[model samples]
Target: QADVLARATTWRDRLGADTPRVAIATDIEQAATLELLAGVMLAGGSVVAERPAPTTARWQRWAAERVTTVVGDPDVARGAPDAVTVLDLDGSTSPRQV
Candidate 1:
């Protein structure tokens, strides 16, 4: 847990993101996923775990959250605002465990 937190802090610092609102589609039950979520929270950021289909409702919800970053496949962030940071971690490092 401590290690995860440290890594999170490092990543957050490197990204220069303060209190970011991150959009992600991941299962919260997984150890790695939970660790990442914890890190985001600990860094004073927020997470959107579900990726609703691109629609008026989705845009409205995302607008309400003021999401700053979307992390996932390229297609997942296709229509996000230009102000939002899109990180295509698809097929990237998949840490199976914490």
Candidate 2:
């Protein structure tokens, strides 16, 4: 899990220290979900789990929870507003903007 933590640390840094909550919106089977959640907690941040659902519902939950950083599916991340940062865990080369 060190590798996961390391990656998560990198992501957390990008998210910034003031970020209070990290949202997870990926399938449970995805290893990155657990790793990112653990990493965020270790960094003294809270976590909000977003159920796998429609893009609108997921984004709504994120907005309602005031999610600072999102770590999971890129598709859902696309729906996040410009205020939220998205860390895509699908191993894609291109990064998701807002």
Candidate 3:
């Protein structure tokens, strides 16, 4: 867990901002979400785990939460504003490359 948190710190730092709000949208079968959630939280960041097809209300909630980043499916990532960084975690266990 500590190791995962360390990696999360790296990801948080890599974001290059004081952003502490991250939104996760992915399938339940994926284990990467666990790592991502832990990492973000360990870095003192908040997380919003959303399903792939989120409703307008949910999206509004995300906006209200001040989501600074979206880490998961590409389509869901597109839901974020242009200023928000979208980290695609598709076809991989780690989020290093994308």
* Index of the highest-lDDT prediction: 2
**lDDT agreement of model 3 with the native:** 0.63
Clashing pairs in 3: none
Instruction: Put down candidate 1 lDDT per residue, 22-73, tens digits, no spaces.
Output: 7775445555555556656766888865655666665467878888776554
Give the Cα lDDT of each candidate.
0.60, 0.67, 0.63
Error of 1 at 7 (Å): 2.0
- Model 2 off-target regions past 4 Å? 1-8, 52-56, 90-98
Quote the positional error of residue 63 for candidate 3 in Å: 0.9
lDDT of 3 by residue, 2-87 (tens): 77666656665654446468777666567666666656765678877664444466557788888877777656544456676777
Which candidate comes out best when scored by TM-score?
2
| lDDT for residue 64 in candidate 1, whole number 0-100 | 84
Could you tell me which 10 consecutive residues in candidate 3 have the lowest summed lDDT?
Answer: 89-98
Q: Which stretch of 10 consecutive residues in model 2 shows the poorest summed lDDT? A: 89-98
By TM-score, rank the candidates, best first.
Answer: 2, 1, 3
- Candidates sorted by lDDT, descending order? 2, 3, 1
Better of 1 and 3 by lDDT: 3
